[model samples]
Target: MQNASKITEERINKGSLLALAPIGVFLVLFMGSGIITGDFYKMPALIAFMVAAGVALMINPKESLQNKIDIFCKSAGDPNILIMVIIFLLAGAFGSVAKAMGAVDSTVNLSLSILPANLLVTGLFLVVCFISISMGTSVGTVSALTPIGIGISQKTGIPLELLVAIIVGGAMVGDNLSMISDTTIAAANTQGCELKDKVKMNFFVVLPAAIISIIIVAIMTSGYQSASTETYSYEIIKVIPYLAVLVGALAGANVFVLLAGGVLFAGAVGLFTNSIDLWGFIGAVSEGMAGMQELCILVMIVGGVIGLIKHNGGIDFVLNYITSKIKSATGAKIGIALLSSIIDLCTANNTITIITAGPLAKEIGEEYDLDPRKIASILDIFASCWQGMIPYGAQILTAVGIAGVSSVAVIKYLHYPIFLLIFGIISITVDFSALKKKKTH
Candidate 1:
């Protein structure tokens, strides 16, 4: 009996620090080369992911070469990666077709017609927040708004990266607060709380942060009030595609279907305006798919490489270390946040990060008599904040892909996520008033 117990206790967790080498290799090769060249985007993101994936494959030397290949292929074929690729394709098609139909310009000029130039950033941020809240998907929000942001930047001569960052911040607001968001679902489910309760609790905490962000944007863009020398000759009819797409998305239409519908709507408008014919519309779609090729490739490679890291217990090792350090209620909350943050850093997918960290967070919360609502809120908020800030995270990557810039450029202008993260830490550490209502069993 003693010998058998010893054998059971000796079980090894596959986790190793060396499993992290691929990611380190990627950042060095990608960012180091960029710094040396003084142009961050000169080395394509796809190339970086490619080399990193190669390193990931080589790291598992104990596995047969064929077995390692199987793991990569399976990870590449993961449902999440496949779904994102589909969305990328549809988003590209819709963006290109709608732009060709003049929808993007029409939408930008239409906003300018109604809102003051200084309020453009504020207006867009609120728009994305509302839309994302309704749709419950940050990537969808970014894809829909990034073109408009790019268009507004073109017309207003603002930095394109700044606009992309602004849109991403807005998207994070919705992702963090939305009742139906995947992060919200994972957190609520794992913490044994009602989703509605989680939403109510989170709103109290994050609303002040939202207000702060809007104020910052207003102040930052105030100078633009005196600089508006541009005029728009936008056609109202041409704006229908953007309007339809926005309305469809807000109504909770399936994202892929929503984007496809927008493309067909744009094509019809294009045909009427002589902007495009059958061949031209088809060419636009092909061109759009071509545009997404690089981003799609990067997503698949990342999914596979990260999957290998997960399989090798790299993520588990980190999770264990973070959980091992908790000693108090505040420490538990902070640990939960840090746990989510670290998992998001490794996964690059906020929803998956929440799922991975939520169970551990729940146990920590229970141990400390922490409120379930607060735990859920921390998980979602930190995940969204981390996802929005990380350069390689899906939210920022999608925005960067659309805006055609390095993620570093956009990270500097992210007002909402930075303020949200600060407020999240403050709410837990300094003021638990927002969470004062006891977690009623």
Candidate 2:
């Protein structure tokens, strides 16, 4: 028994450190290369992760090569990873098809014509926030809004990457607080809080940040060059694709179903407009799926590797370390926030990070008499803050790709996430007496 206990302790520590190694590798490769070259493009994120993921395998026990390979394969092919891959493919197809069909340009021109120049950034920010709240996913919101943001930037002479960042920031706000968000669900469930209670607590904590972000975006874009806008021919029918997708998503339609409907609408419109022949449309769809291959591969690698880490007790090790270090309710909250932020950095997926941290956070919450809602809010806030700022994150990467600019450029102009960090810190340090009172009622 003594020998077994000693061995178990050693495994816990070693596995915990090994689990962290991939994250360190990723950060060094991506951030180090960017720093060396003075360009964020110096290292592609997927390549860095691929290398790190391979390294993670080396830390596994001296097992049969086939067994290890099988382990990796299983993680790489998890249902969640496959789902994200499919979404990436469908989204790519829809984006391409929509663009080819002129919906993107028409939507852009229409947006520019409607929103006044002064309210451009403010309007975009609000729209992104609202969409993310309704859809409960930042990636979905970013996909739907980024092209529009890019169009707005081109038409108005604003920096395209910066505008994309604005949309990304707003989307993250909703991702953190939205009732239907996966992050929200994970946090609430882990902390034993009702979803509604968590959302209410988070609403107060993030409200100041939201308002501040709007003010900052408005001020920054106040000098935006206004171009003479022309009204779109207004393909009212084409607009139905986005409207249907949005409404269906809000109605809690399955994501795959929602995406399928959008894909069908976009493809049908492409057929109607003669943008491409049947063969051409099929080719576009195929190419889109091909485009997502790398992303899909990466997701599988991460999921599988993370699964092994969990199986080996790395997660438990970390949770024990953090929980043992907490002394007060305030410290517990801060620790939960920190835990979620660190996990977000590693996963590059806010929802997954929240899920990883949720159970641990709940135990801490109960021990400290901390409100489950507050704990949930803390997890959501820091995760969103970190995820929004990471250049290699899905939302930022997609936005950068669509905007055709440097990720650094986008990061530099992202004032909203920065403001949010400040607001979150303040809220944590000083209890908002009024907000607390409102919540009690």
Candidate 3:
């Protein structure tokens, strides 16, 4: 819940263009170079981030080198940053433990059992959507659902790419809206909005888009029957942990507690069912923690990098530039949304995009008297949609790589993000609320 470090009045008034160079270096090294190399992951993310951090140190020579390093470290250790990292660990642990103990399979099979074979595609989309919504991370959702989706693909003669696209679409729902999602967290924190408030405002626009996408999936796959293998038995007990996650998130429980409870509950279920021994549970938990290593590193380093940028006035410069053209509430919202989309496209990581865009969007919103809750929704929506669209973005790349297809093959079918973008446009254009009129008058 820690806010960003405050800037002095003089510093804000005298924002330097040089402060923005560190971010530029980061984007060029990570995104521009990837486009040129034709391999998005070719550059090690951590190394590129470190180099950008170094650039901030070099450019801001006012402080001694050691002092600069200290500033970077402090920012990396910010309470908000630490909390985000902790959530990553817990979420990863829950995901690993649940899958190892058959929770994912149980949930998937139970879903498949209820619906007819011909509705497999739409059902699968909904199942993945629910799982991602519960799990609160699209990457985890992709990893968990892709294999099952592949199996269904193989059996039903459904195109693997199509299923991957549907999963990708479903994954975006949680990435943009989940209570614990990094995107949601970043937006809510920076905009000074409650998590529940953001969710409440976001759903008005997001659910309509989700409903439209679901209907489209059903229509597109109307005659397609998944093979007879769709019918599989699942233990009722195994599904309880997943239900706990969904229920806990929706009930407005603290994310940290929800995930911690989920891990313990899932482990207990595994123990009582004799699916895992004591050591095995500990090992599953450790493995899950291990899986979070890459994400943790990226987050910590990015925190440091962003800290240096802000300390040197880079963020102030960006705020000035991005807000300069906004003259109305609608224009301000458009700027906020476009800023997130553009940054996310460059970063290829929606959470990181939101982290970078959130503070700036918050400033713009406050300046224009825009609702912070709606700004939070705009940041999540635009960032997620743009991340979903880019063929080379990590989400698409990861999904296609796992499905053994081209990113382009699945990019076209990511209808959720596209529709979300459309709804977002409509919501911003038509201010149906009396408060909007009151604010203007």
Candidate 4:
């Protein structure tokens, strides 16, 4: 029994680069095929992930096929993965019912009536940031705001993909800094730091990125004219559902409860306004869930594939390699950031990435006499940086799914994530800690 336990531990730490090949295969099939055909839609992400899952199953021939299949299935059915699936379905239902009842159009027209065309994108970025911070969930923010973004795009002719990208970027800002965010909680607890300290540390690093992003978005929309020259009209009643959802989120309601309430309330409004009858409301709910089927399946496949890669030691390999290179304090910070970023790239979930990398980051911080607050900040910031920009991540996927745009098109306009990465690197290279101490003295 002892020998078997030891062997299992050895296999877990037996880092293998070959374990990562399945992801490469997926990228090749998905992006490579798209590049060759000059159209990304030529290759579906679902088909690409399916092929990758097959590759994952083939990697560990020494393990029994049944065991491998069990691992894959276990990952696909993980609690976190299942929760995301549920969120997707509920968000879809809410967005669909709201739109069917004219909530999106009413909200968009109301926004247009208030903000100038040149400031629309900038205003949206700010609004999403505020809501995301209050809600403490980037995916939730994206889910709630994406329909309005789509409506704005159609009315203003401001490139749907770009607007979606802006919404994703703003959502990430809150995800990184929100005190109630899972990533923030995981990172702070794992590093043995106070949540408020971590939030403060993160605020300094992320503030510049957020400010610059606002300026860039403002400039990007400065010369734009609304495609429609006519005045917009709105019904205050149709906007109630969105307002209620936003208020619930800000009040710290559970996400599941908030979404379910949104769906029911939207349906009620639809019925009351005669925008949709009872049968139509039911149909809208079903159609909305159906639209999310592709995204849900892709998420499960990605989870299973990541499970295989981790079981085969792909994540352990990367972890071992990065930790081995740490020679100084700065190197340790970079290692923590890189570890969080790469793991997030594989997992497509920032909260999971932080949980996975946090213990080792704590160890590295102790070894180098580094501040736990900074370590926690690094874990949250870098994870969010990748999570915001990655094409396969939930935030980007949710936005694209709602906006009906390709991930590649949306990625090009994701300025906040890129700026966040830049500011994060700068935070490490320059010692803000010293400056703070100097000012205090």
Candidate 5:
């Protein structure tokens, strides 16, 4: 009887593993080959999903092929997945339209010209950090700041990719810790903690990392020389669209609404200034939407695959396995961190990873007498760390695409992000000894 039970358990585990095969396929067929071929975008992410998802159907023994296909379709058609698809569309359209209208170049030049050469890198990093912390979206921060980052690199003789890395690192720090950040919302909701409390605990840990990063960038850019450039004039009215987007987003507007507002605002400015005719503006918006359709599709497919995997008990299997091995409080904390990080890797979306990992980590926290605050911090920190460094993740991929460098090349100069991870791990492992002592006194 015991032997039979063991066999059943093994079969169940195998089934769970099969449900997660899409992620593996995505990594191997898309990211793996991309790395091998030295082109991250070479393999369309959707093709990878199609191939791996097909394999998932084959791995299931209980379901008919048609049933498996239906399951995949259902998972892919979820509302959250669809929402992300829409966001990607708007983001792409906005970015493309904004660029084509010369907003990017003009903004970049204006920023570089205004800031002192010596403080260029540090100033840009600080600006991005503030924007993301206030706005709670790294992608938004990057979109708002990359043009300027690119310009600063050109004018200051700094390595363009490295400059971009600095901005990415700073923006990620805010995304992980900001009170209004989606990742924070997910973590707080999952753990049943108040947002302010999570931010309070998280701020202490991340502030050190932020300060260190700024100091390092400042030191690196101390001897920079400013290069002169041809003067380009842009209507200040054109700048209002970016400012409006930032203000609206920071004020808690829906992303779709914010982007819509940006589109209208920018279009009006362009039309008034004769930068584009009405039909031309409409065409720009259409082109923008078309540019992002690929990314939007990939989001839908990934979401559906993940939903099916979750519904089929893949996440539960991993969580059960990790929780089973928790022999002590310290072990439990480490396990939670690792589990959150792994989920972040699989999803390449910090907010989603935090939501998935939060409840389980909270349970571990209760069992270990660990502070919910600390658990929340760990979830945010490690997720952001992985999100920033992972080559296939959106942040690094965007940076890689914009800087014209391989993801691997940019990863090397990500000094602040790597150090932030190290500092986080050390603080956790050492029981935050220094902070603990300071509190005691």
Candidate 6:
């Protein structure tokens, strides 16, 4: 009986730090080469992931080589990962068709004509926040806005990296707070709380961060001047495709449907305006999908590597280690935050991290008598914070892929995630129960 109990405990706590070495290997090879060369582009992300995937295959001698390959292939073909790849391909097609049909230019011209130069950056940030909240998917939000951001950057002389970072940061705000967002839904359900209650708690925690981010963006762009002296013009007819996609997303239409519709809509407008021929539209789609090929392959490779790490017990080790350190309710809260953060870092997917960590967090919260609303809020906030900042995350990857900028360059301009982190920490360390009571009175 004693030996059986010991075996169960060991199984529960099973994890190996060596299982995580592939990630370290990737960071060192990718980021290290970038640092040494002073250009991240020198080391392609695809090569780094390929090498990391090799390392993952080589580890865990207990598993047969064929089994390891199967694990990698299964993870690479995971439904979520495959869906993301499809989204990337579709986003590329839509962006290409829209740009080819002059929709991007018309939209940029309309935006520039309406918003003052100094307020363009701030306006873009706010618009993205509203759209993302309505859309409830950060990747979708980033995909839709990145082309416009690139257009603005070119016209305004603002750094492309900064503009793309703004889009990503704003998207993350919605990812954390949107009622329909996967992260929000997962967090609330895992914590056994109502979605509305989680949203209320989450809004209060992130509102200050959003406000500060707006101010910072305003200040950063205050000195901006347009790089082009030429006046911009727009054709309202050409802008319809972008408008359709935005409206459809806001209405909670399926992303795949919206992208496909956007592509066809843009092509129709192009044909009507004689902006592109039928062959030209088809070529544009091929071009767009080709552009996304590298990113799609990199995402799949990363998925495989992450799969091997999880299979080898990397995540379990971290979970056990963090839970072991909790000594109080406050400690438990911090532990939950840390767990979410680390898992997100490893997986590079916030929604997945929340789903994986939610049960453990619920267990910890129940033991410490922590509020479910608060627990849900923390999980969403921290996961979003890490997701927004990580270079490998889909949000940042989508932004960079669209904007044609390096992910590392954009990280420095990501203000919202930093502010979100600060506010998240403050919410945990400082008790707001008294403030809630005072407000009620």
lDDT (0 to 1) per candidate: 0.73, 0.68, 0.79, 0.77, 0.68, 0.77
Candidate 5: deviation at residue 384, Å? Answer: 4.9
Prediction 1 TM-score vs. true: 0.63
Residue-by-residue lDDT tens digits, candidate 3, 1-441: 111222222235656789778778878998877889987767876777778888888986667999888988998888877777887788789888988888877877787688767787888888888877766778778887888788887887778888899988888888766776767777787676677667777787778889999998888777777667535778989999988877777798887898899999999999999888899899999998898788777788877877877788777676665555554678778888788888888878887787777766776676666788888888888888888788877777778878899887787778888998898888888643333312333
Best by TM-score: 3
lDDT string, candidate 4, 334-367, tens digits:
9888888887776567876675567567756755
- Candidate 1 per-residue C-alpha lDDT over 1-441 given as tens digits, one digit per residue, 9 for 90 to 100: 123223223323535777767767866765677568755456665687788888888886888877877888898887756766776677678767776677656655565566666687788788778656644568877887898788778777778888898899988877777644556655776677766667766786678888988888888776654255657567888877766765665466766677788789889999999878899899888887798787677667777877777677665554444445554578778888887887676556676566556656765675567788888889998888888898877788889988899899889999888888888888787654444566354
Give one clash count per candidate, in the order shown: 0, 2, 0, 0, 2, 0
Candidate 2 regions with alpha-carbon error over 4 angstroms: 1-19, 60-62, 117-121, 127-208, 216-233, 327-333, 339-384, 387-413, 422-441
lDDT of 2 by residue, 1-441 (tens): 123234335435443655667657876887688678755556876787778767767765666656767777786676655655666566666655655666655554455456676787788887677657655568867877887776777778887877888888888876765644657655665565666666666676678878887887787788885674655465655656666765665566665666677777877877887766788777777775676576556556666666565555566566556545654556767887787888777556676566556656765565556666777778887888888999878889878777677778889877767877776777676765343522322
TM-score of each: 0.63, 0.67, 0.88, 0.64, 0.69, 0.64
TM-score between candidate 2 and the true structure: 0.67
**Overall local distance difference test of candidate 1:** 0.73
In terms of lDDT, which candidate is strongest? 3
lDDT of 1 at 249: 51
For candidate 3, the per-residue lDDT at 316 reads 69
Clashing pairs in 6: none
Return the clash pairs for model 4, or none.
none
Over 84-134, each residue of candidate 6 has an lDDT whose tens digit, in order, gives 677668777877788798876676566556665557789888878866764
Of the two candidates 1 and 4, the one with more favorable TM-score, higher being better, is: 4
State which candidate, 1 or 2, has the greater TM-score. 2
